[model samples]
Target chain A: MTHDLTTLVPLPVLIPLCAAGLALALHRHPRAQRTISVVALSLMLAASLGLLVAADGGPLVVDVGGWAAPVGINLVADRLAALMLSVSGVVLLCVLLYSLSEGMTESADGLPTPGGEDPIPVAIYHPTYLVLAAGVANAFLSGDLFNLYVGFEILLAASYVLLTLGGTGARIRAGAVYVVVSLLSSILFFVAIALAYAATGTVNLAQLAQRIPEIDPGVALLLELLLLLAFGIKAAIFPLSAWLPDSYPTAPAPVTAVFAGLLTKVGVYAIIRTQTLLFPDSPGVDRVLMVLALLTMVVGILGAVAQDDLKRLLSFTLVSHIGYMIFGVGLASEAGMAAAVFYVAHHITVQTALFLVTGLVERRAGTTSLDHLGGLARVAPGLAVLFFIPAMNLAGIPPLSGFLGKVGLLESGVRDGGTLAWVLVAGSVVTSLLTLYAVVKAWNKAFWQEVPAGVTRDVRLPRGMVGPTTALVAFGVLLTVVAGPLYGYADRAARTSMDGHTYVDAVFPGGSERGRGESPEAGGGDP
Target chain B: MNPEMVPSGVLVVAIGVLFAAGVYLLLERSLTRVLLGFILVGNGANLLMLVAGGRAGGAPIAGITPVDEMSDPLAQAMVLTSIVITLALTAFVLAMAYRSWQLNGHDEVADDVEDRRIARLAARNAPVYRDVDQGEAGTLDEDAAAARDETERDEAGDKTGEAT
Candidate 1:
């Protein structure tokens, strides 16, 4: 059945946001709140799928309050957006299920409650989780740049609550860093948006696509640079990524999973949108992106290598791998953008799976430190397998999604035939080898060594936890096998991105040429 | 376009100064000072926004004034949005700080100087174990640094233990 736009577009964002209010109000009723959270997310998943199918090649745009383009707020969902929303929905579902199980068991077993009075710490978890999910969904679906900023605010606001959900000292200290850095980034993002709107007199992506090209070369560069800096800080590129590793690993496992899964990708998505739609040049912005990608790759992986904690190592690896996707964007060709899209999808699944596996490690070993954890393979072969597949994939081992994505990126970079492209190709190759080493280090230290004494090894995997972990792992594996069809989708997405005329037409029909304000020939000679 | 009026470069320098100050104060021990630093930094960023948008308009909304006479109202709207977000962020941070003080008995990064020092001293005082003892199976590992620190604190019978 065909989906109605009015119902589908708004519900995906509105349901969880509404559920956040509901969850907060029903704080005393733990089960009711949890049920409501699940129901809201489930509906979001359905709606996201509906929109994805409906908006495969084309886009779905609805101007809120009946305002026309350039004046009113619009919510547009193209294939890339739809793909992100679907990925976010799946990850949120997994995280929610895992949280529910963890919360229930902890509540029942007399785990040291946060407030000491509330036996079930349901009051805190439910509302915050719902809000975080709502924020993520909003971010994925938002059309206008300002609207996306709002979505980011919603997500980060909820994240502030989630990061410090438990008032532990470590969580508090880490939460402080998270809040300050995030605040700074938000401020920068606001400034960028303000500058962009001033320069172009428009905030809508399609409208900005029309106006930005006509702007002076210097002005255009400033706006693009400002926006890039804001997004870069959020995306955790090499120099901008210090706060992430320090803060992310300290939060609860489920929160960490969701954050790792969806948040940074939103930043990457924004960069891709701005780079492709706003400025399409062979060497101008693409060169800068290429440098950032290479540095982000090399530095992030090296940081990962130094970390003794599994979660910290993963966090660093997270930053390192962002380079691959950024490299894809840097190429600015159809294949390059396509490879980036493919990498983003692959990275989300693999990264989220790896974080969830850390949760499993935390549970079985009683600590996430590589020094403290050992012989997990012998004690818990199932958990070992769970970790191994994604670990191998993340390292770009053969017959996995990571390998397919990197190969696509590398091939595209090689074909692009620029100095930046060659650097990206070589950087990714080096990153892959380093990533493999880091993964091997974690495996050898945590899974292959002898177990310490006085630790009664409970290798028995929890029924509740294993389900979500297995599902994520299977999804990553499926991406590997289904690379052909997935690549076809990416190919279409990349073409639409490169040829902004298609996206502009999707947003403003009969005004396609009108939307491209200044022709490339009229502008600073194609940079 | 008037360099004799407001120099945009000064605003950039101001943003740099504000960011430097914010980063410095945010790294300080006191939570309150950190909050003030953030506020300053935020204001500086908002000023930067004002500059970036070409520094030439009142607001972007229509119907309030003559179309030709009106300023870039978009920057004004952005300022309003940034103000709202900053207020919300400040409130959240304050709430977190209050909650943290209640939980940990201090607003400083380190919860208690004396206790932390004592714990470190106790760790220095304790004997290190190279090998895990099989006999200690089922019994908690005394050599476990974290657990040992906890035991040391418990043995010290300090006032900080009561906070927990």
Candidate 2:
């Protein structure tokens, strides 16, 4: 059964990549491009779901191109990876559908005249979106450190194109800041990987997990710090987050929704993988992480509270909610890790749904500015319900997955009983309340306030656009309904990751020294 | 670990200098300079990977070079991959920079509109400085008083005048 599942490991990455090539080739045939993209992503989602179920037994590892663990790249779909892959697959599919529907309406409107020419280059969008999906899958499933880096580059490259899709003045400016910052982070990550290889003589994650403990404490700490800094920038942890709000709001709504949902979460996922699998017991680093998490929550929400633009406000809230995941990781306990994983899943759905709803608002109301938006509740009652559910879910109102995840984190924090954990607990509650304030402020302005002049209320929302968004919001609600089993699976995943040996042993079943590769020196030579 | 595989001091220094210069250039506002800085830093990182592979040796060929004499093939492979990635990214950034220039007539990184707005607000709300604390020569307090409701201020002023 495990061997059978291992064959499915590469499908999520492979199918989309192959489809991307096909999509690019068929760019002239927009219908064919759409069909190929939809089919490829649906198959990827199926594979991810299969992996999610199979990986629950244990990690399923595949050595790509028949190369073994140490010498060759591998993809491992452990529980955490499988869970992340599944959520991302769902999100990518929904966003793709939303964009496709959007493109259809846009073409129908005949807005792309001689000068304006379609803000989103429709021909390239499918291929780039597919590549982005593949990249995200690769990042989640990669068992090798260097392969993870490759995955990051793939996704980031796609993101750059998406962010500056139309090459408008604002998008170009936003893309410049985004591209520069991401490049810097990538460079830092590369440096860290190089140094890690120097110290450990291997870039394979399983081998590193074995060898890292034997290295000098100071060198190990340096590697840890370097990796954290690199991932922190990607994850947009407090101090490294300024670029996100500025860059994200400039993109088209579907693109922004996907980025808001998946991109930074990839960084957070990396942090969880490394901190749990590679460096499991460092209280001092954990303490520092706690402090940073506290600041990220407070500062990010404060920024959110101050935003007049709805997209920008959502972006800030996205940054703020990342703090909760960091808080869970900072606790460095199984319970905390479980809650973090669950919270990550919850946040991805809720945040994406909110952004999609914002897109619908922009379509119906003509803008996403809180100051200009008004009477949406009276104008579009269904849209109001859609926005209200996800908005409340994000703010962690009772009976929602967001609230459940937060409660789990807070419970874990109290159990840890450390002063820093206590402070973070307090910080999280305050952040939650402030999030409520920010979203409510947006709600009141956008939904309840009198309609601003010159804004049309009679615009119709296309069924195609609303269908996928509604499905996604319903998926968010489904997370609340299935919270029990999901949290249980998360707990088991947390246990497996925190233990570390299960992952390493899965990669090198016999022992730490050898893989199936024929190379005499399976692991790399030492410096 | 091999005793003879120590990295050269000169190489390490070169890496440091490249990184320092790259970071300095990175802080500049122009997208062109930032792209150049990224290329420099990327090269420095590639060199660091080379250094990580230990002392240079013969090409890592199975039959052409002995095992002991062969350089670390893995590091070389990684460096080559990174170099390709950096090159691709360089092309993309160049395109973006050109696009930026075409759109705005310049390729300088612009400040975030929201951040700039906040900065402007902070400047406006900043407290004014006065040389003398008690003097009424355009003091901040006097300004506040002048800005207050005229009727309320007159009543308070009359009361204070009577006390004086």
Name the top DockQ candidate.
2
Which one is best on lDDT? 2
Residue-wise lDDT of candidate 2 within B54-139, one digit each (tens)?
88899998899998999988999999999999999999999998886675555677766654444544778953432221223332
**Candidate 2 residue-wise lDDT, A345-368, digit = tens:** 999999999999999998887677
Global lDDT of each model?
0.76, 0.87
- Across A7-91, the per-residue lDDT of candidate 1 in tens digits comes to 5766778888889899889888888988998898999889998877777737776656555555556677777888788878888
Tens-digit lDDT string for candidate 1 (B1-164) = 22223536777798889878877887765566778787887887777666655646434446666555555555566777878988988898888778767855645443222234345557688533322222222211112212223433453675653234
For all the predictions, what are the DockQ values? Answer: 0.24, 0.27
TM-score: model 2 vs. ground truth: 0.92
Q: Looking at model 2 chain A, which ten-residue stretch has the lowest summed lDDT?
A: A105-114
Docking class of 1: acceptable
Candidate 2 ranges beyond 4 A from true positions: A104-116, A519-527, B1-3, B122-164
